[model samples]
Target: SIDRKVGSQLMPDTSPGVSRSSQLDSETHPHVDDTPSSNEHHRPTPLPAQLQGRATNKTFQSMTYVPGLTPKIAGILQSKVPEGTVITSTMSRSPPPPNERSSVVYRLGCKGCEAKYIGATVQKTEKRFSKHRSDVRNGILATALSRHTLSSTGNHEFDFEDFDIIGTEKVRKKLMLLEAALIKQERNRINIQEEFAAIDNCYNNLLLNLNNH
Candidate 1:
């Protein structure tokens, strides 16, 4: 018969205010809730310095930001990218070293036009054709096709293999000079044929007019 408050709005404290007994369930239950609240302050979380931007979808939570790195570390990061990426930089560098002897197609022939061209590379082959296309389109190299040679054919069927690379600057210059020489030689041959035909036409015309006279 413990006297306690019990009404429509307020519930009775049936147990006689025991501090640590099963009878004191409401107070003990809320003390259990306090455990969770206490844990919130101690819960492990990634520090801001260790937080990384979301990679793909999963957040990277263990990386720290480093301000600067040695050249060796910089190189490691650069190499992580898959090959075929065009690398442009402000640093001036000499041309690549001499490569093994390889074949290069230097000419394309048609009834009215002949194009002399140098194309292809192999040391790192993945994006060589891409570079060639960019060069041709940008007018860095003379090209037989307005677009990439591969694109003009609409398939991989027109792709030609170039095994030869005049690797050093000197050799590259020499190959260029040789290409010019070959083009000049062809022009000379075409001129001779045109001149000989002209002469023959003149001679035949003269003979016909003379006979008529």
Candidate 2:
């Protein structure tokens, strides 16, 4: 009882789960369909090379034709952004040399006259100008600018350069109150009238208008 047709559909030759030598091997296999015939298509998916390959019937609704999905999203944003990474906004910095500063408030003229000397130091104004040239080389007037540089006689002097910060304060009582407001805004100051008479001229006109700017 074996026969096969399939044109009007009816191929049995051995039903109950076929096996009569595999239904006589279906006369050497013929009717094989897993659903596709109706003109069987599906071979279109090409247009890609940066869309410069022009051919737009607009299909997949636009992912620029998906392959490598936008270069795998730009290679995952260039491996999470970091190639010579530089983004500054307003980069500029430079100012730190005056003898490595430090809570100072200095000034010390007198290369022979107009004698000024306001001072202060938490150290490192070149180590407080080397302790005022070691208290005028060991005559130790112990300050008041070493007793006006060892007793002011016309044309006084004092050396060892680099002085004149005039202000800075990491607070040592606001750096000697900015060295008593710059020795109460000097005027040929040699700093020692009880150190500008212990400050109190009702802010001597705001310290002489901050020493005229």
Cα error, candidate 2, residue 5 (Å): 99
Per-residue lDDT for 1-213 in model 1, tens only? 234433532654465755445545665575553235666789887757535663434322221111121233345545885432323232166533323323221332222233323332322433544555575556562343333333343332223253233121224444343333333333322222222232234444433343344
Show where candidate 2 strays beyond 4 Å.
1-109, 124-126, 130-171, 189-202, 206-213
lDDT of 1: 0.36
The most accurate candidate by TM-score is 2
Instruction: Check candidate 2 and list the clashing pairs.
Output: none
The TM-score between candidate 1 and the true structure equals 0.21
- Cα lDDT, model 1, residue 115: 30
lDDT (Cα, tens digit) per residue for candidate 2, span 1-213: 234444435544545776766555556675754467766576667667876665445322212111222344445555785452322122157647767777777777878876778777788778878878888879898778888877877646764474667566675865665577667767777777665454567867856764665
RMSD to truth, every model: 22.7, 22.6
Reference-based lDDT, each prediction: 0.36, 0.63
